[model samples]
Target: MPQNRPRRPKVLCLDDEPAVVEGITRTLRKLYDVTGCTKGTEALAVLEADPGFAVVLSDMRMPEMNGAEFLAKARELAPDATRMLLTGQTDLDAAIAAINEGQIFRFLTKPCPPPTLRGAMAAAVAQHRLVTGERVLLQKTLRGSVEVMMEVLGLVSPTYFGRTTRLRHLAADLATALGHPAVWQIEVAAMLSQLGYVVLAPEIAEKVYYGRILDQRERAEVERAWVQAAEMLAPIPRLEPILWIVRNVRRTAADMAHQPGASPDLVRAARILRVAMDFDELLADGRTSAQLAIDTLRGREGHYDEDVLDALEALRGGGQRSRVAEVPVGALAPGMILVEDLALASGMLLVARGYEVTERLLARISGYPADALATDTVRVVLPREQAEAA
Candidate 1:
């Protein structure tokens, strides 16, 4: 068997002058897979086609789009790619604009020596590696930790975990329906939004979960618990954005309207989560149907984002499309959504309706005594794909 060589990092070089682009490619060809383009528009097209480019280098004075404008668009196209600007020694204004607009990693003056250009390309590649490596590490470590925490929540508080799981799916769906970006962050926020309930007395948590009215002191205590949960998660690396959503899941759109430096996406995500959670709770006690719950939310003026509410209303029809069936506990499978509250014969709620079953959830469910369940047959909506197959 032949040993395979490691793949070189891809570098995209763009300039109005074909000769300059060719020069850049020549300097970095040995260490990188270089693609040279004479126009910024053409380079942008290349970037859109293959976002795997590790670095993008552009000259300051391009015909259609200057270096600053090109790199700024490139940032939106391939955020992980490191961008650099090559400018004339007198193009100091353009260099500053590049830094401010494109978040250029580095800028080199024109007539740059081959050795210096090579080193700059090498450094840009290294920066790309650092960014991507940290992202991978964060996903593996932080996301894995979150998964473990959710599993523990299942073990300790199955009811809340079920709510968390359902909310996560709902948040993702609503985000897509609303055409919101960064849907994963909204999903993660939903998954962890109920962490505060873990510390609450079961009765209080159940009341909150079921949307029962709370007294002043009980409401205050619940607020304290939410803050504590956010504090506990604050120590996790790269989790600030998600934590912000979780902490503000209860905040209305108006509440966040005037807050300084608040991101629109984050605000939208928080609103999405808030609506999903409240809607879930409305149906939790089995007293309200989806339409009635939506109506109730609509009546609460300015309490939620109108756009998010519209998305929720639109997604309501999707549930009716799924094929619902009653299955014995043992026959239950992943991807099925619970259609009714899962309870014990003693009338204790184990899991709420709308939860998507998973293997981990099955493991948790198995811990209950056979005779403890209210019924052997449980109602579930088969996932759309499975329903189609059936």
Candidate 2:
């Protein structure tokens, strides 16, 4: 029989007080690999030097930069590491800000019991694992669903909604450049943010996408779209988090515009998506791609992160065009098609035939010339009658 060894968890503790650090180290050293720091600066250096630490527990009121600031920086540096705030103060505003900005996994007050601290650390580690695993699965699932949803929207308004794939890629690039730990949320949000459009009539969706100013009733209807989107996605387990972010996406932007110091990650993600979606609309409105990207960066205060804007500018300057494969109209089929031009969305190609198109299979085939035969490269589905006749 083989003997089992106890698992040792790595922990980084930051506190200005030597006595407190000593006490925590003594209590946790038996089960955890503890690294203690007296200041945020030193802790950051230690974290930079050692990336193996699984959890960071920091005191709230420290000199130079407080725990929230330290945790915010830590999130960028070691996104997989769990973050927690330990504070003696009971300030509600500060607590909310810390959770929102630093994305702290747990909050603990001074004089915490050894058992309580242990429990919190355990929970934080578990959460870190859960979040990472969920993101991987979500990305895989999203790779397919996002295209389907976006194509549906494109069918409603090709000129405006056709750039969904572009907006998603832009949002992801911006989020990564800005060092957002929850970049997955930004990706999912950008992919599905316009889900509310599905509820509205095609004309309404077009009006919203084309920058047409909405009247009072239209504004109300548009606002309600978020709630409707949330309701629509509530049934799915994976979509719940995205729904939360999407519901609050607008509010996050408004908050950032008013309060610059708040939740930079959330604000940055929302801003990127907002600007990217709006830029696509601008392109739809006859503005050139380069000009649209440049104008978007220059026009607004709370529209996008400066680094993201710079990246977009670089993308434009580098002539980074989307490669879409075009299938001849004569060879069109009932499957997927990759448009080889940058005229519309770039990234994933089109799913040529879905439920709606399947129903109209005969109508589509009737329009094709008798001599025209579908090519294998074009990806087509044959109607049962056509297959039987052949």
Candidate 3:
């Protein structure tokens, strides 16, 4: 059987005038699927139904919501969609100003020639493909790269490496609660947040993991590690956003509010990472109960954003249940969270509870001579889907 031809990219045109909607739709429908709306609000409804529209063209002047306002909201609704502004002579300046606010991809003056409109739509379609294509690539490749890099870090820095793993899980939970997109970047940043610790003293990693207090000088070293690790990862392709989030993971909420120029995604990822890291520190120390940790986070002014804390609290209220299974070392796989202290015969802590399991970590654990180990069956908290399967 022959495969069906792929559908053409969809375009949305919004204007208060029926004539304008018909004109734009008629001009583009021959080459593309066009959704035309005479009301900006109705267009928003159209967007809500199918956010996959490749291009949004809105007139600069309209009742209630103007082009800029509509496109701004549209940008939030479908960030990957390319936005274009249609402006009259009198509204050109307003449209230009709205460019910054709406993050519009292109603008066309009123009475645009059919040729010019076609070209602009073509360019918008190309831009949409570029943006959405890059996002897909990052989602596929970067996720694997982050996993392997963190797993390799485990070979030399098991304690702090484990903290990064735990933080990733917590960050993911918070992201889901807030309907925040870009969760892949958030999870990757949480894992890489501990990269700085790999260069610090071994004892320092253990201390930080266990929430052991460090003197001023030691604290400075930890801060330095944070900066250094972020710097190292900054040059990698498609990792710039995650690095920014990781570098600012320790910044106060006040600092975040003042950095008006940073990407909202960056701010969001950083805020969640901070709360999760701090919350994990308390858990690792065993000095505070889960409820107490939540309370402490709430009172730490300028530390965790209120919205972030609220999301975390909502997540906590649900009681995150864990599913554990006793499995031999040979059955271990990457990404599992250990529920017990994995130790060698000499009683050295090989790995700690709440640690994210990885292939490299498992390899080392299994490499230990059989005579030096007491038991082969390790208890691990399986991922939800896997637990369900079991």
The TM-score values for the models, in the order shown, are 0.84, 0.55, 0.86
lDDT of 3 by residue, 1-390 (tens): 458977889999998889988998888988999998888889998888889999999998898788888999998888889999987847556867679888999878888888999999999999999999988887879888888887667656667666777788889989887777888889888888888888999788778778889999999999998879878997898777777787777776567656645677778778888889888888886667788899998887766779988888777766564577888867778767886667777876677676777665767776777777766878988877788787
TM-score of 3: 0.86
* Tens-digit lDDT track of model 1 for 1-390: 457988999999888998888878778888899999998889889998988999998888877989999999999888899999888857667778899999999989889999999888889999999999987787667666787789777767878888887888888899888867577778778888889889999889988988889999899989999999998898887888898888777766777656654788788888888899888888887878889999999998878878878788888865534788899987889999888778889997777776778897788779888899898989999988888888
lDDT of 3 at 24: 87
Candidate ordering by lDDT (highest first): 1, 3, 2
Judging by TM-score against the true structure, name the best candidate. 3
Question: What digit string (tens of lDDT, one per residue) describes model 2 on residues 1-390?
Answer: 346875677899999999999988988888788999998989999888776677999999988888888999888777778999999989988788788878988999988999999889889878777877876787778766766666556655443344455566667776676666677778878777877776777567768766777788888888888789778777877665456566666664566546533466656666667666666556544445666557765787755556767776766566443322344444444532233222213332223222212223335445545444333243223444444454
C-alpha-based local distance difference test score of model 1: 0.85
lDDT of each: 0.85, 0.68, 0.82
**lDDT: which candidate is best?**
1
Better of 1 and 2 by TM-score: 1
**Candidate 2 structure lDDT:** 0.68
